[model samples]
Target: MVGIVIVSHSSKIAEGVKEVALQMAKNHPVYTAGGTADGGIGTDPVRIQEAIEAANTGDGVVVLADLGSAVMSVGLAKEMIDPALAKSVKLANAPLVEGAIAATVEASMGSPLAKVLQTAHDARNMDKVE
Candidate 1:
């Protein structure tokens, strides 16, 4: 199973996305990283790294970020992780809610990391283009 990590500016947002993913992918591994759950800033590099490491047990891990800081924090965390694991990690451009759901569905279906990211991107684009 492919592991998933949800990063957001607000911890609640991250958790909400994770919850949706979990509902869609009951058997897959899902994790969240962010700040306080009460709408505070959730961009801690250490927390993001820990979440990624925890999610990346054996299967590859997919990271979904909400905003700029969420992505930056994941990038910083990647630098702190082992090189091999870092190579398997990917950042998804999908938005918080839809991206998490699409990623989770693709990952659960045993899609490659690249494809999962693409699915998330496609899902995001569908919303904009349709």
Candidate 2:
């Protein structure tokens, strides 16, 4: 099954999203990469890289980041990890919370990495008013 990583400037946000995603896919792997080394609000490439490593399980990993800087952090994190493993990671341009939950559900179903990333991206187009 594809795994997931939540990246956020605030550790609480990442952890909270991970918690919610886990609710939908209890058995799916959902890791968090949030805050700085000092426990402040910021993104850490090392943390993100570690999370990506833990999330990957041979299938792939879908990363959902909160902001632009967080995305950049993920990029740096990818460079820090093994090239082969980095090749299996995809960053989803989708809403953090919704995307995480959606991706988690899709991955829990044993969906491919592409499908998981697509499901998370599709969450951005969802209409809440419907």
Candidate 3:
């Protein structure tokens, strides 16, 4: 199954998203890289890269981040990871919570990397108020 990584400025947010996503992807790898190395409100390349490494299980990893710096951090983390592993990782441009849950569900269904990524992106169009 494709793994998932959640990157957020707040650890609580990342962990919360991970907790929810895990409910649907019980057997898949789901990791969180939130806050700075010192546990502040920022993103860390090292931390994100480590999360990516932990999430990787040969299938690949999809990363969802909150806001700008978190997104940039995931990008930097990708460059820091091993080249082969980096190739298998993708930084998804989707809402953090919804994307994580959607991606996790799709992944749990045995979908491929592309399909999982697409599912997460598709969540952006969901009508939550409807």
Write down the lDDT of every candidate, Cα atoms only: 0.83, 0.95, 0.91
For candidate 1, lDDT tens digit of each residue in 16-101? 88887889888788898878445478688888899999988666788988888778888999999999999988888777788889
TM-scores for the candidates: 0.89, 0.97, 0.96
Model 3 deviation from the true structure expressed as Cα RMSD, one decimal place: 1.0
Per-residue alpha-carbon lDDT of candidate 3 for residues 1-130, written as tens digits (9 for 90 to 100) = 8989999999999999989988877877889998988889989999999999998889999999999988888889889989999999998889999999999999889899999999999989989785
lDDT of 2 by residue, 1-130 (tens): 8989999999999999999999888988999998998999999999999999999899999999999999999999999999999999999999999999999999999999999999999999989995
**What is the Cα-based TM-score of model 1?**
0.89
RMSD score of candidate 1 (Å): 2.2
Cα deviation of 86 in candidate 3 (Å)?
1.0
Residue pairs that clash (backbone atoms under 3 angstroms), model 2? none
On lDDT, the candidate that comes out on top is 2
User: Rank by lDDT, descending?
Assistant: 2, 3, 1
lDDT of 3: 0.91
Give the number of the best model, judged by TM-score.
Answer: 2
Clashes of 2: 0
| lDDT (Cα, 0-100) at 95 in candidate 3 | 93
